[model samples]
Target: MKKIIPYIFLISVVSCQYFEKEVPSEQELMEKQMKEINWKEVDEYPSVADCEAISDETLRKQCFFEFLASTIQQKLSVDTLSVLYPELDTIEVRVTINPDASMQFEPQFPKDTVAYDTIKIDSILRVKLVDFPKVNPAIKRGIPVKTQFVLPVIIKTEK
Candidate 1:
């Protein structure tokens, strides 16, 4: 019985190792791709004022300066998070923007003067793994893993 138990344990350990998923090389590939992405293209936008005009009054007043931050400015100033893991066939990214309410705008400020407001905007990016043919084969075959990246985005408007 002792011998049989030892054999069973040995077999189980070997089988577990055999069944374990291997790490994919997608991390290196993703990092290379991320480094090559055109940051300017991602940051470029038509107008900040137009973007701000669509927000509610509370957001409008609170995020007044943030609403004035152009995509270019944001791209130039904000940091980005990027990661790659195995098992994800496709990455679905969702962006959400939340404005802070503590900020107040002073109407007396000059048009060109950049005013600092207490309002802060939270930008969240949600990433999910999905089944798709375009995903890396190695990643698809490995253990399923998903990753999310969040960034604080300041929306800007035109003068």
Candidate 2:
């Protein structure tokens, strides 16, 4: 009876699954990892030389905008149009900064200001932008990312 009891116990223990947990498949594991990641926001922002000094996120963002504006303003010659088109007050420049820091842009001017030649404006902006310094692009999960900005350049009227 004792030998039979020991044999029964051994059989019961061996038959019972010690580790019942199912091992996840590679595809399942990968899908789970992907779901864990947050894809909406970048971990780091695109930064210029001047903006790098700022530590605060909001302030750094502001500095970045200001830096780009100042750089573009320096190269852009608004005076050329002032004499010909005094009515034009602003130009909205749409810029896309690629992951590699290269830029592409389109300028939008008011339709009412027909006297202002758009080709001339585009040429001037394109040339000036070519000289713009390469900036560090935004990053997400250690990968460089592209970003876009719309900047309104106010035409300074001589007072």
Which numbered prediction scores highest in lDDT against the true structure?
2
Largest TM-score belongs to which candidate? 2
Clashes of each: 10, 0
Q: Which residue runs of candidate 2 sit more than 4 Å off their true CA positions?
A: 1-19, 35-38, 109-116
Candidate 2 per-residue C-alpha lDDT over 13-96 given as tens digits, one digit per residue, 9 for 90 to 100: 887786567899999999999998877777887888878888998898888888877777766654465556678667789878
Per-residue C-alpha lDDT of model 1 across residues 69-95, encoded as one tens digit per residue: 333234323332221212222212222
How do all models score by TM-score?
A: 0.23, 0.73
Per-model lDDT: 0.32, 0.80
lDDT at residue 78 of model 1 (Cα atoms) = 32
- Native-to-model Cα distance after best TM-score fit, residue 34 in candidate 1, in Å: 4.8
